[model samples]
Target chain A: MILKSAEAKPHIVVIGAGAIGSFYGAILKRAGCAVSVVLRSDYETVKASGFRFTSPLGDLSWTPDHVYQPGETPLQTPDYVLLCVKVLPGVDRAELVRSWLGNHTALVLIENGLDIERELADAFPDNPLLSCLAFIAVSRTGPGTVNHQAYGQLVMGNFPKGFDQHCEQLANLFREGGIDVNGTDAVVGERWRKCVWNTSFNPLSVLANGADTLTMLDAPGGEALIRLMMKEVIAVAEADGYPMPPDIIEKNISGTRAMGAYKNSMALDYLNDRPIELEAIVGNIVAIADRLDVPVPHLRTVLVTLRIRQGVDSAHSE
Target chain B: MILKSAEAKPHIVVIGAGAIGSFYGAILKRAGCAVSVVLRSDYETVKASGFRFTSPLGDLSWTPDHVYQPGETPLQTPDYVLLCVKVLPGVDRAELVRSWLGNHTALVLIENGLDIERELADAFPDNPLLSCLAFIAVSRTGPGTVNHQAYGQLVMGNFPKGFDQHCEQLANLFREGGIDVNGTDAVVGERWRKCVWNTSFNPLSVLANGADTLTMLDAPGGEALIRLMMKEVIAVAEADGYPMPPDIIEKNISGTRAMGAYKNSMALDYLNDRPIELEAIVGNIVAIADRLDVPVPHLRTVLVTLRIRQGVDSAHSE
Candidate 1:
């Protein structure tokens, strides 16, 4: 029951218009798809000015056809839903996605790490889910601007069926929108590979209270520790039946080294004295390793140190 | 034999008159000691304006009788030399001390750690070596002004000998000059005890990349890592036949907690992107543990991480 090329454009609803969400939404809008974004009230400036995308390929700007808050508008489920929120523990995402989920909705998650897909599936079992691994260094500069620091393609795949025509249709839509989308059966492996990079590099950046460049390039024992953490991650992934290849891990490490002077989000949060998304980034890795009977000694040590640094056990006095 | 109280004051030389050195030199001058300081040319502002001490106890100013650079002055050994340089690797401290080491010279190292005493002893075994544990929160405000942040006290003793009469005389001089100088038989032990506090807290502060209060009070597991690092240090000290009591360690931790919003020197260095004294603080502890056959897993991890952080292998690039 796939729609043909002569039919009207598919309606896409992009929730949480942060940097990545905005980037994809702008691209889709430029390609003649009807795109709408649900954003916070604070992002009114973005709605007014439209989004400006500066990339190595070229610069472009796009204004969404519609912008609405979660509860303010009479909602209609779109043909496609893209969830782009900062994933943290205790997030009420299931309830947030309830009104947006319809019989025909296809959802794609563009957040960091894995397990969120499982969490979503557990909550909304009947809905379709697709996982995406974004390699671009996109960050929001202002209300309606995303600074793409580096250029890379997106690898996506079907969640429940492993890979099918639905995944191809979605990839075709992204391709029409000028996004380099690779739809593959190995999407789960791709997501886990990205997880290995995040788990090893992100927490170390936070704990060292330094930039990514410092952690990857300068810190002693940093590279060795990163390799060890990645090795443990790969071991756990293999035990769980979704291991990353050695070459991919090496490429990820090398990519980070090449991006000199860029501070990871975790390090930025630490410098600003904000609570980190530790559980999602590193704690989950430790928990998974334990479940799979894999020894992640280096990650565990770093986890304990980060917890101590954050004062995890002490009751808040104020 | 101790020199009797006479009409003329004994000559005292203070090396590295930045803050702590200037504070002591100013006080010594006030107490009728002929104080001369060897300082860098950049500290000409302090030399021009004299030295100002701002403390809760009282405020005072003193103009030193003489000031000279490392090689500018004619060679002459003083009765006492107070070494106050910040510890760094390959600093050639032995050679620096040699220029001022006369037969009767009593060299007292009032620096941050205990290893300097061993370094001095190894360099000039015959000269009387005095080890001092200085507890003060003082910093240079300008060329000649030092801000006494909070507390100040000195625990001093002679190595390889019980309280020498000269030690008692120096203690009397410091006491008369309004300094809390405690002469103990186990000054080396006291020095290591202070190090246990620093080795645990200083690096944690640097790694946490926040004020002492945040790590000590606000963060979870903050105090636990402090305790764990201290435990490793204590084990190493005991293996070297100088066992530190749990109570002393507890007091140091509690004292740090009480002094909220304080930033350690290492944290300041990291913030300013200056080189840190990693070897003097954490590396020396690791070196000692290795030599003594003590397994210091926690310390080893921290040491390696710090070495990576500073790009110790690629120091020239920094």
Candidate 2:
């Protein structure tokens, strides 16, 4: 049931509340906003005990105001619905958010990959779509438990351009929860920048048989391979009219080295037999490169190998 | 002990007698040569029952005249010593062959990969170094038992260039044993031609998680990936002064499709945890491409991923 109040407070609904969503939703809740969650696997545990977060930002036990399973009707109208699910195969993001889209609800997608906003934008042309990039080291330790190991900075903006009041409001709410948030006019550019890392390490980690970032980086020619892929991605970005900064590759490499031994999200998914985000992360980037007549052999090679793996795996299952 | 013969025959010592060496050594023995083998893992089985072959070229069970273990001294080292071991990480081909190099024994290398002869050539400057490439589908089903499925052709020549009497004599002997053998003056060029297929498929099969030929070809974008890798290899070949035939890519693709669900040797090695010839196959190709400043990102990508797998596997063992 919707909570009745003398005055309506800003309400946020978190879709796909695994780790990123649950953590961010808790932060918004701490900022005095009413936060709800849509969950699948962790629905029972989270509904019973709420969320126990052991984080460097200080441990917190947050209980979402409302816990809703997927396929349920929209119980309350939300001012913002945070789409935080992985963009994997069979995940129709636009369809997932369609039923929950109220007239004034602005959808914010805090996910990985390039060219992710087009589907939602096409489905709801009038609704404001904000895209976000999360640079955080967080993982779900168990059901309803999240462990945040490192940085949690977020950059978000309006879909095709300029920042709006909705973006500003969300950024302020996130900041109030004690994490850094940047509301930029160039969110797409920021995505390309982040993709320079994602498109390389994510697929490489899986391809290397669940190797950690440092294992890959320390292997002979591993660093060069990463550098070449990043260069190809930067070329694709440049061709797509979003040229990255001059030192982006060095910055990315050094940043990854500083992160120590860490397995990327896709690698973890692969090891756990969960579907990886190949299309959204690498495939779309390769497609853009192909359309722009840019040569991205490294990216294409990774895409092809990963696709072959998926095909072989499905064939075995069949 | 040397076999006492009233009439002396060509004494052929076969080193690294796994599958390819065993089959070819059997064929040579069938051609009325005194064929001996150097075996490690299969020595007992081979010494007891010899080899049982099942091939469309006509099955034959032929016993070796002698089976010598590793570290044994030179035993009647004669006209030829065929080295057929895999060029894996720990294999020292030069050291393995050094003790058996008789003064008159011409060393014939029936192995895969380019630049493989340099180590032997550097070691035995006085003896004739003949390099041969085998295009065959052969596997050891059990110890001392080989199943030769298809095409057993041999291409042999002198190290630098020019066909000699030794090459012609070996070719004739192979032809007598019911297989085609081409003695070429441009054997290096022929190697580059064969590498167009090896460099593309071998590492790719492993990277695709032990995918067979048809599985890889039929996967979405798989054929395109192979074609791209083939083109890069061709580019490297051309840069290295060996321009391949115009239809090499198409011919290779079609020939592979006709092979029907074959897993390359490297893929089989990977699946069985046997040491793969990554350095000899994809690594050398990339090295040549890098030296020539050729853009072989596809090949380089495959090399990098495989190297990472090697690193990760070794780390786990440690």
Candidate 3:
């Protein structure tokens, strides 16, 4: 199934060479796995200079086994398919990877949003799927540069639960890659827990642009809004059949306070004028809240404000 | 008694010669009134080159009767004192204007805010206070230049009641100055009416920086928020003993829509890095809403966000 030994290295085709994809690809390469990447803006550069990774552990540069653009066909089917693209609404992602993915390949999705695994799993029900959570602070600084500022780990489990040997094999690949890879039987709980942090900080960081986690918390009355957002997320998650913990709000607040000044991905995206991960992160929760008849004024406000910004931008373009 | 004739021009003291004061002073001067100004930033420039008025009506440049700093005492009390300063909290306004105001000087308090009349009236009980509102698109472009783009009028009334002879006289002065002046027995009601627009646009224009009125209105969910703000303002005003009409929200929305692209004074102030009149314009309404036990979550959120911006600015300064 997965990687048996270092001699027979599993070949991985990384579908998105973003910060997450690059980080994982570099780690997998270091773990003695054959890694190839399909990139958007970084194909030419990565093919030339390779990936330059800067983490707290150390810094290293390495070239993957191969790099290809979207149109470039794969001559061979890889053992694992890693999907790390930004999951904005209206993108046909299942269609994007179908050309290279075969029946025998397993897919690992390491994204920071809600309900991202549904489409891929539905597209390939027979294929092995490991829904993964990448708890790492990473950013693609340049063409071949990946900066990991803080936490780095992979919390993975069998898609729809109950870990098998395949889960162990895939996670062991990451473990052998010089990063912690923890397994959980309750992946939905982990997703909700991750959403608890993402929903609170992501949109607020974008809306409250240029402010970090602590700076936003220190904002006047911001502490209350942040806390309310966390509570609302937990409530919405519960209503949606995956409840977060009771102490999660206090825990998140104190934990973020300790993280000091850190900009979430949404903030970075907004600053870079990239499309925000609104629907995947905040909109999904709001949709669930709407379906469940739960009032999440704070979260709803963030959603509406972002819609306004998007509307303004579109109007400007037209 | 009021002025006997147009030939007997009223002498008025214009304190706080910013945009509002300068505009009113220029208008009063155009109406054949002798206007003396106490200026802060524009003193030297205005002294060197008198005010240049560029309105849709005409163009004119004229020096006021006198220009003095705040420390410079007036030789004598004038017939009227136009208090056009920003009505922010924490400053002793009464004491600031005490030296220039005397028994017969009817002070027309031209400001944009809630609960402004009480303090001035309380501080100078015997003085005739005309609570006034300016409905116009005007801004000070430079040191001695005012840009009057659209809709110019003065809606005024006696501080606590029906129009007195002084109010009539002041109304006539503005009328002769080529501007319409409307009088009402219910000044508070009119204030609430004006607030329907101010509350919707002012802070939003600032917070949603670079966004004019229509752009904000055209924002995806801005229509609902704007309408809700108008409704909440009406409710708060009613709780404060001043009931606006039922269809005022629609009326305000349509009126603002028709205004096309116009930035509120608060927005201009924010863009220029000048301090916003948060306490005077929005905070006072939120306070009243709190007192009346009215749940105005939207307005309260606006208040808090502005406070957050203010807090961030203060922290940056420190």
Span of 10 residues, lowest total lDDT, candidate 1 chain A = A309-318
Residue A71 error for model 3, in Å? 1.7
How well is each residue in A1-318 modelled by candidate 2, as lDDT tens digits? 234531255888999998899888988887778999999999999999999999888866799888998888677888899999998778888888887779889999999999988988998888889999998888899999999888889999999888999988889988988889988898899999889999999999999989999999989899999999999999999999998889999999898899789898889988888789999999999999889999898889999998998887777778
lDDT of 2 at A94: 85
lDDT of 2 by residue, B1-318 (tens): 234441355779999998899889978877778888998999999999899999887866788888999999766866899999988767889898988887878999999988788888888999998999998989989998889888889988999788988998888888877889988998899889989998999899899889999988988899999999999999999999999889999999999898689888888888898888898888888888889999888888889998998898878888
Best-performing candidate as measured by TM-score: 2
Q: Considering lDDT, which of the candidate structures 2 and 3 is the better prediction for this target?
A: 2
lDDT of candidate 3 over A80-151, digit per residue (tens): 888888898777888777887888888888887887788888999988887889988888888888888777
| Model 1: lDDT of residue A28 | 71
Q: Note the DockQ of each predicted structure.
A: 0.22, 0.80, 0.39
- Which lDDT value does model 1 have at B56? 76
Q: B128 in model 3: Cα distance from truth in Å?
A: 2.8
User: Which residue pairs overlap in candidate 3's backbone?
Assistant: none
Ranking by lDDT: 2, 3, 1
lDDT by residue (tens digit), candidate 3, B1-318: 234553388788999887678888877888888888998888999888888878886874669888988877787678899988887656678977888987888888999887888898998989898999998878888898888887678889998778998899878888777788899877878888888888868876665654678777877668877787778888999888998777888787888778678777887887787778888888888889988998776776666666766765666668
Query: Scoring model 1 with DockQ, what do you get?
Result: 0.22
Model 2 CA deviation exceeding 4 Å by range: A1-8, B1-6, B57-59
lDDT of 1 at A3: 40
